[model samples]
Structure formats: structure tokens, C-alpha cells
Target chain A: MHEFAIARSLVDAAIDVARNAGVSRITRIRCRIGDLQQVDGDLLGDAFSAVCDGTVCEAADLCIERTHMAFDCERCGTTFLVGEWDWSCPGCGESGSHARGGDELELIGIDGELNDGNQSAPKCV
Target chain B: MMEIKVLRNVFEKNDRAAEQNRELFDRRHITCINLLGGAGSGKTAMLESIVPILSQSLRVGVLEGDLATTRDAERIAALNVPVVQLLTNGGCHLNATLVQHGLEALMQHELDLVIIENVGNPICPANFDLGEHLRMSVLSVTEGDDKPQKYPLLFKAVQAVLITKCDLLPFVDFDIERAKADIRRLNPTAAILRTSSQRGIGIEDVADWLRQIVNERQSLVAAP
Candidate 1:
């Protein structure tokens, strides 16, 4: 439902980054989405494509990397991916809770070309 | 030709807006609640039952977020409480920016507590923050026990989970204990309560929870 909003923001953020580095055309957008957000990757991709119209990232491909929600056992101290509705620590019988790396909705990076188009300037964003 | 590693959150703008709104509420000494639930999850009914109880002692206001209709806002308005209805125009969820705009109208009233009833959605609303002090998700008994597992993020992010329409338990196949247990697993610390707005059960408990948060914020503002 909010994929369009997210895609708009992503395009805006990408444009800002590209403008800063003197990039003229964007070709790719890499995003890391976590399992916790209930986001539909196909929907986000379509939304991204729609929102990128006329922008530098118009032809950019949205690459989404999915990650599972992980839990670091409070007692056993072992980290494991939380299966469907299961918070039990796989290392031990103790109950596990979400610790880290679950709720990720990051725009990891963008691939674009420089304005001059002679030699691509690879400046870190 | 160039790969710039941005490594930024997609919701950064929303998060920043939410923080600003949160600061405004905190500075005004008002406790805010972001009420979220799926459609027909009894959110409006729950509010109808609790608002009167809360208004008796505290100055309360409500911001209703809906896709199109003003019906929810009208229901809240009938209670003689300060209410504002934000029409999202088919948007599935209410973002911080919308809430920020809604706050402008509600700010006129001297309110002790403000409840922003989010758009009826179990999935999308959970992803957005509305600068609230407390997060409450209403899950009606008719929705079944599998909801928690289906929408864990909503359950996990909330501080309180109100299992509404408990009076229908005998009529429906929903298991109250299983529902509570599922919510408990996803969110161990969340206060889980069984409520039936139609039957007037557990309204005071919900009111008490709101009061606890309201007083906690008010005392902090009054302190050195």
C-alpha cells in the first residue's frame, strides 16, 4: 500500500545523491528489505518504476535484497532467524525475542553515470 | 559506471517528521496515542466506549484518519470531544506529515491526551510513525487467532493490544487464550487485554492504561 510513497522517497533520495556526485543518468537502485515489513517486492518494484518516470533513474532497476528477522537469545546468547511466529531460541529451549537485523528498509546504493560521460567519477555517497 | 553506497533508510523523511511532531507534543505536555487496527477491527467502537470515560477527568481530543468518509470523525464529534478528521484520499495509512497537519487544528484545545486513530490497515499503518507516545492495536475477536502471526510487525511494535469483540467468542470459532498467547509471543512486554466495546467490557482497563501514560507525561512536564 505504501510502496508508492517509499518509491517516491527512494527516487528523491537517489536524485539527491546523484546530484551531489555529478551523476547524470541512473541505471540501478539497490535496496535491502527485511522480512518484518510485510512489503511486496513486486509491488515496490512496479511502484519504483512508476515513480522514477522522467527522473535520472527512469531506467534504473530496483534490486531488493531480502533478510530474515533474527533473534539473539537472551539466555543462550545464540542468534537465529525467527521462523513464522516462533520466538523460541533454536540454541536452547528459552524464549527468544527480536534483537537485530529484522526491520530493515534501506536504500543501499545507486548505480549511475557521470555527466561528462568520459570517465565515470566514482565518488562515495 | 559509479556505484554510490547511500545506505539510507527509505522512511528517513517520515521518521524526521515524526520526531519533530513528537517534540511538539512533548513540549506541550500532551500524551499522544497512535491507534491502529484492520478494517472492522472495532477501533472506532473502542474509541466510542473509551472517550467518555477518559474525558470525565482529562481533556481529551481525537484525530480520525480514514480513507474517505467523515463518519468516524462524526462519531467522535458526537461525544462533544474535540475531534478532527483527516481524509487520506484512498491512502492506506497515515504518515507523520498528515498527522503533523492534523495536529495544527487539534492544538487549539488544551488537551491532556490526543488519540490519532490511524487508517484501518493492519499491514501498512504499522510501518509509519505518527509521533505518538503509545501505540495501541485493536484486534477484534472475529478476526481470528492467526492475525498476530500474520501481522507480527503490528503486534510487535505496539505497547498495548486490545482484543476487541470478546463477547463474540462463543459465537465464533476464535480462541481467546490462543489469541492472547500468540500476541504475547510476538510481544512479550505488551499489555494484552480482552475487550468487548458492545458489551462494555474492559473499557476501563483501556482507560486506565491511557491514564497511566497521560499522568506519566504530565508529571514529567511538571517536574524540575
Candidate 2:
């Protein structure tokens, strides 16, 4: 349902990265979305193509990297990854453990060929 | 051609607007909370029970955000509390921009606590920050215990979790312990409170928590 806005933002980001790199066309866009975010892959895919109309990323490939929520124990300082929704700290049974590396929504990088007919890959900081 | 590197966040614009809202609330010494949950989570009912009780001690106002209808606002108005309703039409969630508008309309009256009842949806509302000091989620026992598991984003971002409709716990198959465990697993720090707006169960506790939050915010501001 809200995938339309997310798709628009993703495409907008890819186009910005591509245009700045002097690439006339986009080959692929890589992203990392967390499992906790509850994003539907199919809906995002559909929205991406629809929102990319007339944009530089019209034919770009979207690659998604998925990760589960991970938490670190506050008392014993133990770190573990959780597959299910339960987020208890594995070490000391204490709550309020800090979360690590889930809930990410980022455009990691873009891959495309330059207008001069040479394949180019721009590295992002 | 020269390349201009841009690493802009997709939600940077919304975050900026939310920051402005935070600044405004801080300046006014108002404690704002964004109440989120699925439809029929007892949001309006919970407010109906708490506002009058809280008003005895503090000045309170509400900004009801919904897709259509001013029904919720009308409910609060019956209690004689200052409230404004923002109609989103077909939008799924209420963003910071809409809330900023709501604040302007609500500021006509002096309010100590401003609770924004967001549109009833678990997923979309998690993405938009309405410039609130805290986010509280309402979960009714009838909505199943796995709701926290199903929508982790709402649970993860919320400052506290309120379990509503507790009066029916004897009739239904709701697992209170399991639901608490599930929420703890997702959000270790979220304060869990159980209540039933129908029976006035734990309403005072909820009111006490709200007062503590307001007092804490005041102390934080008064700190050097």
C-alpha cells in the first residue's frame, strides 16, 4: 500500500546516483531493506517499475539485501540474531538490549555503463 | 560532465519537518505523543477514559488523524477537551507535515499534553514521524497475540505498548504472557501496560505514566 512512495524514493535515488555519474542509462540498483520494516517485495517491485516511468532508471535492475533483527544483551553483553519476532537478549534474560543491523533502508550503490561506450562502476562513500 | 555525489536519505525531507515540530514542542514545553495501532485498537476509547482524568491535573488536547470522518474528534469533544481532526482522504499514514498543520490549528488553546491519534494502520505509520516526543502502540487482545510479531516496525519504534480490552481476557483465548514475551523480544525497552477502556481497568496507571513522561520532559529541558 505504502510501497508506491518507497518505490518512488528508491527510483529517485537511483536516478540521482546514475545521472551524477554521467551514465545515460542505469544497469542496476542495490538496496538493503530490513525484515523488521515489513516491506513487501512484490508490491515494491511493481511500484518501482510504475514510478520509474520517464526516469533514468526506467530499465534498472533492483537488487535487495534482506537481514533479520539482531540484538545485543545489555547485562551480559551477548550479541545474537533472531529469526522470529521475539527479541529477547540471549545472555541474561534482560530487556532493553540494543538492536544491531536490522531495520535498514538504504541505496547501497548503483552500477551502470558510461555514455562513452565504456562500462563504468562508480563507488559510493 | 562532472559528477555530484549525493547520498540523500529518501525520508530526509520528512525527518527535517519532524525536527522542526520537535523544536516547537520543546519551546512550548508541550509533551506530544503519537498514538499508533490498527483500527479498533481502542485508541479513542482509551483517550476518552484518560483525558478527563488527566485534565484534572494537566491541560490536555488531541489531534485525531484519520482517513475520513471526524468521528474520533467528535468523541473527544464530548468530553469537552480541545481537539482537532485531520482528514487524510486516502493517504495511508499521517506525516510530519500534516501534524505541523494540526499543531497550528490546535495552538489556539493552551495545552500541556498533545496526543496525536494516528490513522489506524500498523505498517505505514511506522515510516512517518509526526514530530512526537513518544510513540505508543495499542494492541487489543482480540487482535491476536502475534500482532507484535506480524508488525515489528511499530513495536520496535514505539516507546510503550498498551494492551487494551483486557476485560475480555477471561472469555477469549488471548495469551497475555506470550504477547508480552513477543513484544519484549522485539523491543526490550518498551513499557508494557494492560488495560480495558470498557471497565476502566488500569486507566489510572496509564494516566500516571503520561504524567511521568511529561515531568521527565520538563526536567530534561530544565537541565543545564
Question: Which model scores highest in lDDT?
Answer: 1
Cα lDDT for residue A27, model 2?
63
Tell me the TM-score of each prediction against the true structure.
0.92, 0.87
Model 1 reaches an interface RMSD of 3.0
The lDDT values for all models are 0.86, 0.84
Q: What digit string (tens of lDDT, one per residue) describes model 1 on residues B1-224? A: 67788888888889999999899988888899999999999999999999999999999999999999899999999999999999999999999999999999999999989999999999999989889988999998888888887887889878999999999989998977777766766677899988999999999999999898899878888999
lDDT at position B150, candidate 2: 85
Q: Per-residue lDDT tens digits of candidate 2, residues B41-105? A: 89999999999999998899999999999899999999998999999998989988898898898
Per-residue lDDT of candidate 2, residues A1-125 (tens digit): 77887788777777777776778877677788888777899999998889877877777767787877777786888888874555667677676566666787777767777778665454433
What are the per-residue Cα lDDT tens digits for candidate 1 across A1-125?
A: 88888888888888888899888998887788888788888898889889999889887888888887667677878878766655577788675444465678888888888897733334324
**Chain B alone, TM-score of each model?**
0.97, 0.95
| Candidate DockQ scores, in order | 0.53, 0.31
TM-score of 1: 0.92
- The true-versus-predicted C-alpha distance at residue B79 of model 1, in Å, is 0.8
